[model samples]
Target: MMKIYLALALWMIIAEHELMSGAELICKRRINAEYRASVLMSPGYPFAYPNNMRCEWVIQAPEGQQVEIIFLEILTESCCDTIELRDGNTSSAGLLARYRGNVSESIYVSTFGSLYIKFTTDDSFVFNGFMAQFRTATTKTQNCTVKLDASDEPQLLTSPGWPYGYENNLLCTWTITAPEGRVVSITFVEFETESCCDYVLVRHGKSMRSSMYELGGLLKRPFTDVSTGPIIQVIFRSDSSLSTSGFKIQYKAVKRTKTDLMEIPKKDKCTGKIEIPEAGHGTLTTPGYPEKHENNMNCVWVLVAPPGMRVSLWFTSINTEACCDFIKIRDGETPTSKKLGILSGHSTKFAHYKSSGNVMRVDFQSDVTKVYSGFRAVYEVLNDSSEEKCGGDLRAAINRRQYISSPNWPNNARSLYCAWNITADEGYSVLFKIIGFHTFRRRDSIQFFDGESAIPFASLRRNTQHDDESFYSQSSNMYVIFRPDVTTVQGGFRGYFVAVPKRQRNTTPSILVSNLLGQHGRDNR
Candidate 1:
């Protein structure tokens, strides 16, 4: 028997070599339980196989006997070049195993009867393919179908005959039930299937009758579905055409937590109020101004300009917690108004807001932790007619104060050139108070001139440190000029000028002189 096997093996090798080189020969032989082989090689034997080739062979045994095959070496183009095994020779035979990837140890057991092997290669990457040996098994094994049931303890599931293309007209289903209030997540370690013709469907719910969501196509990565409750069902179906290597899936169940829920800030209980004047503008800040704001707090500002004019707002700076804390701008004063946009995180670009009517609302909310530097914005009247032209003349009575504002004050000040000639009744000095100021630092400016010459008494820009301070002019006639560039715009200044009578005696000091004269004067004498 051993001599006969050796002779057949040598003859098969010689025939394979000749056939690979385009030669043909005829031989008649029958394989039975006694058939065995020490080695089997691809067509080219030890040399690299030619590209774009497909080949098949069959090894058979008697009834009630299985086949066992072991790989000695395998080198081929990874996935693109494949060697596949089947349980029988007929077209109805089911797939058993497949080889790809780099050379590795491989062993396979086939069902009763015979095992068929197929090798295919692409146009590129030719390598010396695999070599293996096979023999008929002396004992019987279980049937080829696969079954799986996954619970809290994770389990792996696959197609009917994994690592190989499933037989035609097959329907397989696996049910996975996790603990109550927990969801299942499926991670694909390996996957391949006929995309539309033969597919795997994954549905959520206790059964298919309840709810269903298909797993789409074979994925290269893992997929987790938490929306579906605790139950998941997977179904695999194959058609009667081309088959492919199936899939391997790893599944786990995860519990629901508090973070999964969404958090909405309470707007009705916010803590700020803002009302910008028709010709005036003002700066609004988060609770802590430039510092990080407190967590778990909601701040709201209601901005109202003149009746005919609309309100405009722009953020000078914003740094806040991402997602958890945000600033929402609205077009109207109520909660049901049209929503503009919500902003959060550290942003380099600026944000601008415009109201449809005379009123606009802003709301800010913070979460439990990770507070950051809040925000500062200026809100002022958007004068549709004025075209953001600042500077004008002002005349006030003695001991009276008059309001003055930047062009389109509170709104973004565009490229502008304007001047204000402020005069009191010839005898009073002018006092200027900086109410709210924001502009391009140093580049855009508001200057207080002594008279009409180029010399300036005070120059102000977006310097937050000193913008809030006050400045007084010695002369009754004061010239104020504002020039803003178009490239960088910001909320301009809001201020007022008050006229005071010159050389007015200090009334409190005069009263002190009268009180001291009657008693302290006699003691001094």
Candidate 2:
């Protein structure tokens, strides 16, 4: 009886092995029309799959029919074990989708007669593998594709499975048609999707070739666009991983006239040229700044600094309709110059932009739609010669030295606000040493920042004196600022900087002096 029991146990083990091996073999084959509907699974499926695996399968439908795959269950090591779906019968076919990790129920359809699937695993952790089924389906049977016709009333469109989050591995197309002599216009009400893998594409005509715009990510405000012709196509695609709440849009057909196509002049409240005074600083604001700006605005402000100086601009407050309103900055006097940046959205954090020459142009444009509190920016002129100025953009090189000092340093420096931005190449750090420093202990201050951050990492105030102090930056950039109260003035500060290899940085204060002396000695010799 014991021998019989042992034999039964051995047979059971053999049966389990056979099942596992059979599943592996089944995963690496080609299915034909003989099997109109079938299942594909990872080896040892419903259990943790083995590590280090590369399996492939091809599901082929009859001619004129496409293949559709439905994933009923999916679980794998996130990002390490992956499944790739292709549109043809071979590995080199156009990739349809790729998936990893614990994916929810999803579906994929092929554009042709065959669908190829590949599963790969790295030599690490494992998890319960996936189970999917494939079947043949015609294009008309697809539920996600739809067509709409023009009407006096607008039509509202939404992503499939809206609000509940869309399924993965989806390619949904929506085509809108207008009557003869009319065009289509679409206004997005809400748009949010998996930014990296899900997007909505807009095209001008019935075919997919005349591309108009592709939009993704979370939309902060409403967006509107008009089609050029009587037909428009919108396509939304999501890959085989994450999903989001999707989008909602209202589309309508409109008759176009000559007046609608022509550009009309907009009345703006603020548009002019700003000249920096001798103090080398000035401020600019949008129309009704600190409050909602007026719509249909087309404002321009050209800032001119004194000759031989550059313009450094910083925004203290910014809020606007993120979609249709903008503040565009150019690096020179006219719109044809290189664009520095386009500011939109809402942000209270301070950011800095500098021009290459003495002129910077700012243009503000708002569509006829929404409005929000506008922006306020301050501009300062930076002297080009370091010997005659207290602040400028400084670059440090290996084994080389650079110096910065207060305006008319070694003399009593008065009311001033100056800044110096020091940077070094990657894999290196900046070493700053104070050769001479003296400031009012109560009112005057000097700040040191590790990067472009608004907060300073170190500071000196309250009658501080550091004749031979050193500071090391954590990264490749450092920012220094000096601000003195108007009441009293003292001998300001002087500092020299050098770039040091991050791997061999010396933090000792005395080494800075020795290094500087050694460089000076080399220069003298």
TM-score of each: 0.39, 0.36
RMSD of each: 24.8, 20.3
Q: Write the per-residue lDDT of candidate 1 for residues 63-94, one digit (tens) a residue.
A: 66656566778887653578877656642455
Q: Please, what are the lDDT tens digits per residue for candidate 2 over residues 289-341?
A: 67888777889888888887788676656788765577888899876677677
Position 392, candidate 2: lDDT: 85
Q: Which candidate number maximizes TM-score?
A: 1
Displacement of residue 255 (Cα, Å) in model 1 is 32
